[model samples]
Target: MVRESLKILLTSCFLLLFLASCTLGGGKNGKLLKSTGQPYEVVLEGDTDSIVTKILTEEVPALPQPEPLCRLIQVKKGKIHGSYLLVRTRIVVNIPAAEFSVGLSRNENASPQTVIRISARSPQQLREKLNPEKLRQLVDEAELEHLASIISTNPSKQNREMQQLVKKNFGISMNIPAEMQASKKAKNFIWISNNASSGMKNLILMKMKEVKSEKRAEEVNSEERRVKKTDAFSAQEKQQIDSMLRTNMPGETDSMYMVIPVLAKRGLWEMKGDAMGGPYVMQRIRRGKTGDEIIIIGFVYAPEMKKKILIKQLEAAISTIK
Candidate 1:
């Protein structure tokens, strides 16, 4: 009896140490192992029904422009990998057996240690409990979180000269990538670009005079302006923006100019004289009533490359305007 008890105790102690090692052995450089899915993509594990699939993959129409909230949010079917197993910012949906829950956890294995998890009993329950709008919002939040991580890694990678120019002229500080160079700096305007051999990414910052209206503009005491209106996605605003681009963005000669083909969404620009074109996002930001309004434009001129990532990068940079 004594021998048997001793044997059991030894086995239990060994098992505890083994489990602890397994839990702790997986990280490097204080970062979780890199996740498996591509950037903006999620690997979904478990059985999904038509409703769940539609909810996960459907394009979000509510955005100023209709585009798949999940277009960049690619999803694949598989069990959650060990790398992203503990990631706190995750969307995890189990089958009929589990209950709904949302909480945080530390994934010792992924680059992002925190994970956001969503748990539900089943696809039907998930759909029944969450509306389409909420679903889209969750996905948007996740993507923004991922984008923020990218920005945090290199917050000051932008050119110092352009930074100074923007601060001096616009009184705004921008977070730009070091890969970009200051291309144009005019009165109350600044343009920066990464003029790579094959493709180019551009950022434009311009200040607009606010006309006095019935509602006096609120005075903002901040050094930088805040993005006030998100109405640029409207057709009328797009037309106005198109007009602005035609007048402000010049081509090499008088006959050549940039034009927006579609005013419904982020407009596409093409040089009349040249074969250059890409996608662009434009926004008008304000600093309450007393401060001037500013227009920030982020565009990509990558003809042969994928514009989604580049455009997203521009969007991320422009979003930094405080």
Candidate 2:
């Protein structure tokens, strides 16, 4: 009887341990549930009135219209157990602790997940110590990671041939989607586009020699500007960029060309002598150790649809620069 009792206790313990391990691993199947929600969407929990929500939902500066940096769905702490656990990104605030602190965890309950938790002895301390910019940076990094994962996992969605061509010409790797066909290619320039009827997404790549004068001008402009640091362009900088765009990105007609309008808002691009205009993002990066610079511009022509998400997706594609 003593031996039988010992055997039963051992069996129960083993079973309990196995069940606990399975739960921690996400489920009995030993697989994590795929994260849910659209890109840049985040599930926010805990104190709603805190700066966390404000920063997450704040309008992105210098855009043509109001658009939040992240789409947020609020939830109470008790409600974060089931499907909420599968959200791609989450932020929790005001948890009780000895002192103010912030913590981050990845893939805790689901794959491709980012969970940020803020703790403090009191709500006041949490608010006082929290750095809004730091929180924003964390959220941005999480969203970018989520975007990169999406692009990397789905080979069918990416245009490998175009990416390879970019590598051959510029010696840089970029993940271009299969939907964007190479519309035009020239000496050190390539134009790729989706060519959709409802809306179109375009990307331009150009390799140019780095000029010391341009670098000095940028530094001078930076020192002279009294406004807060933003992506907005100075008048002289706008003219220089516009000239470069016109020389490379010409329109169908001889008289028409691409230009950044004087009244153009940040990230806006328009075609001269034409009615076509949309949002654009441009980045100039040094090409390896060479003196050449690679110019990447992503633009969208979606007049009818909301452009916030579309521009962000384009940004993600551009970010694949390696």
Candidate 3:
């Protein structure tokens, strides 16, 4: 009986030590593991059919068609213990609490990770506190930063020659992808394109004289100056942009030119005499208080492919402009 008791005690002690080592070792390994997930992907921890999920998965506005801002991988809260903790981006919602709160943390379990936690006492409070636009903006910003980081780190993937040409011509630097080449260059305009057979990805850089009207000046300097969609531009501004595009982005024939239609959704660009068209993202930045304004436009012409990701990649590349 004494020997049996001693044997049992030893077994229990061994099991305890083994479990303790596993706990410690697992934590350390998790920290060492690099974050994993596709770009623009977020692991959402909540009921798949909950309001939180629906709000998060809503289509992003201003696109040609319906497209979610972030690719969501929904998982229940109880199942988010192991590999899910290592996702590059995560959103945890519907957490029960006495008071509502939202918090964000980075690199908690793996390098380059973002975890957002939202807690509320009831669904109504959650709905009130959760702003779909703001949530989409937050995720979009994070994804852009991640993509920019990847592009900046991989110098070999960048088009050094085209980047140098841009810097020389426009006095600005951009991380043009290696696949793209300079298709056209002028005094104040430069066009870069991959010219792929499947589809074309193009970037246009142009310098424009700033409109000096007081109200226009204020709007230009205001935070609202950041162009989010084609609808943000006034009729006059759209006319001016169309004129510029006609002079710069021309097609094969004399009558063919690019124009942003008055009723275009999400900055859609159409070729006047050609059937080719796609989504475009444009941003205008004033170089200095009295310097020429810079307009960067990234557009895709992939009729045979899904364009959201292609446009996203171009957007990421454009975000690297300095």
Per-candidate clashes come to 21, 0, 0
lDDT (C-alpha) at residue 203 in model 3: 91
Off by over 4 Å in 1: 1-37, 50-53, 59-81, 84-89, 97-116, 216-244, 260-276
Give the top-scoring candidate (TM-score): 3
lDDT of 2: 0.75
lDDT of each: 0.61, 0.75, 0.76
Note the residue pairs that clash in candidate 3.
none
**Candidate 1 global lDDT:** 0.61
> Can you give the TM-score per candidate against the true fold?
0.70, 0.79, 0.81
Better of 2 and 3 by TM-score: 3
Candidate 3: stretches off by over 4 Å = 1-31, 214-240, 262-266
RMSD of each: 7.1, 6.6, 6.4
lDDT of 1 by residue, 1-322 (tens): 9999999999999998766655632545343345445545654444355454466567543122334445323234455555456443455455564687655455545545444455677766777675666655665565655665565566566567776777888777667777887477666666788878666888877776555444434435433444456343445445555566666677988777777675432566677777878778766666674457677777788666666666767777666665
User: Which is the leading candidate under lDDT?
Assistant: 3
lDDT of 3 by residue, 120-225 (tens): 8777778888776777777778777787777788988899999998899777788988889647887688889999877688998887665557766765566743
